[model samples]
Target: MAQDIGRVHVIRHLIEKSRDRKIKKMIEKMMPILLVLAASVCIATTFGILFTLVFETFEFFQRVSIIEYFFGTEWYPFSSGNPSFGVLPLIMGTLKVTIIAMIVAVPFGLAVAIYLSEYASGRTRKFIKPVLEILAGVPTIVYGFFALTFVTPILQIFIPSLKLFNAISPGIVVGMMILPSIISLSEDAMNAVPNAIREGALALGATKLEVALKVVLPAAFSGIIASIVLAISRAIGETMIVTLAGGAMPSFDFSVTGSIQTMTAYIVQVSSGDAGYGTVIYYSMYAVGFTLFIFTLLMNFIAHKISKRFREEY
Candidate 1:
């Protein structure tokens, strides 16, 4: 009877193993199809948005001169009588804010990342990193209001020339908004540097700073640059902060502290039920949006290229 029971148990174990193998094989067969489906969804969404933007933008160009849209310095598309469709001023404003944001974010963010990656104790890092990254979850509208009600007031004390509503105020707030992304990405990259490399450098009596700045930084350079590029892309696409703190004047000017309207701000202005449907001004918003999409797409492409080129292999 014991032998009969052992035989039955052995047969059941074989059956279970065979069933597991069959299940594994089935999953393997479906894996490629599942992955293809996932990739197709992403591709389809991208093409869908591109098609929408292109169709509307082509319609916009039919109502406005492409050359004027690209080269004209002033933007007064909503003027009661002689509405001009030039978009350069909006472009200038966007660039001004983005440039200022990078100026504030890059050096300071990188410095924080380095300190967190190389110097901080494990307990300190664990405590501080979450606190710092919590900034990412902060609503952009809050940042916009803070820029208007807080940062601007502080800046006015030091630089009395600063305007109540200007590019610099929003730019600073956008920089703060982008800070978590920069620090998180850069620290991840720096942390990915092998312990062996640090040990190898230290074996030669190199100082910790030297090891960090020279060995770790070079290895992590690609990720660091990618972070900065992403931060720039993030800044350029921002709307609420720029719309609230950055003034609505779409005038092409080089003054950092002056009132200017970004592409995003202009889009908001037009979309606020100000422009009638099917009007030239309404179409111009699509054109401006397309321009912004292309600009951000180009920046992301460049970042992808940079990170791809310099990706370090272990």
Candidate 2:
């Protein structure tokens, strides 16, 4: 009887050991699969948002004529008979704001970045960097008001045709809005450059300016250019400032003195008033927004490619 009990205990112990090993193996295998599942969920979420935009845009296009949507000269939704859906004017307006913003932001932001990275002392940098970033944190509506009430009047002094909601005012304000992004990003790139590289240039008797302009700047060119592109994207997608300060006229004229409508401004225009969802006017908003999203996405892709291509390995 004692021998029988011993044999039974041995069998139970072997079964328990096998079960534990199988459970351990299963857990180990599942961990990697779980990680993959988490990553897939994140990617799916991103694609889902994009898919929502695309699907709505498709619905919009099904109702509206593509020719009218893209090439129509006027964008008066509530005006009398057949509404003209030419999106060219809005595209032109968006380009005007983006170009003006780049013009304003690039030079000043780069200069600030150069100063902060190459010239400023640690103490000065500590003081100035935060202040510059504070510009980024300021509400866009405040900038819009500033442009409307302050900058527009100032611009009118130099150019008489500048209106209350001219492209110039909003463009400048949008530039200001993106300036911090450019400055902060460019400064980070410049700072990332190896100290040894700077020191080597200096050792060769190059002036600080020469080292900065020739060596450091070129080395960090990818990052600087990426920053500029990002700034342009921000300018292109700006909503509140352009909507508030820019005139809603969808004119094809490239003049900064006139009020022009941007894509975002148009979106705001369509979404704000009495346009009900599922209507042609309301659906048009999705189409326009999808176009704008594509533009920004392309810009981001270009920036990413440039950054990846030119990334320096230390």
Candidate 2 weakest lDDT stretch, 10 residues:
305-314
Deviation (Å) of 224 in candidate 1: 0.6
lDDT of 2 by residue, 159-273 (tens): 8877777888898889999999999999989998999999999999999999999999999999999999988888889999999899789887768888899999999998888
User: What's the TM-score of each model vs. the native?
Assistant: 0.86, 0.85
Which pairs clash in the backbone of model 2?
72-86
Tens digits of lDDT, candidate 1, 1-314: 99999999999999999999999999999999999999899999999988988998999889788998899887888788887877888999999999999989998999999999999999999999889868989999999999999999999999899988898999989999999999999998898888999999999999999998999999999989998998899899999999999999977779988798999998898898667888888888889999999989988998888777766455
What's model 2's overall lDDT?
Answer: 0.89
Residue 139 of model 2: what lDDT? 94
- lDDT of all predictions: 0.91, 0.89
What local lDDT does model 2 show for residue 102?
A: 91
On the 0 to 100 scale, the lDDT of residue 8 in model 1 is: 98
Which residue ranges in model 1 land beyond 4 Å of their true spot? 1-41
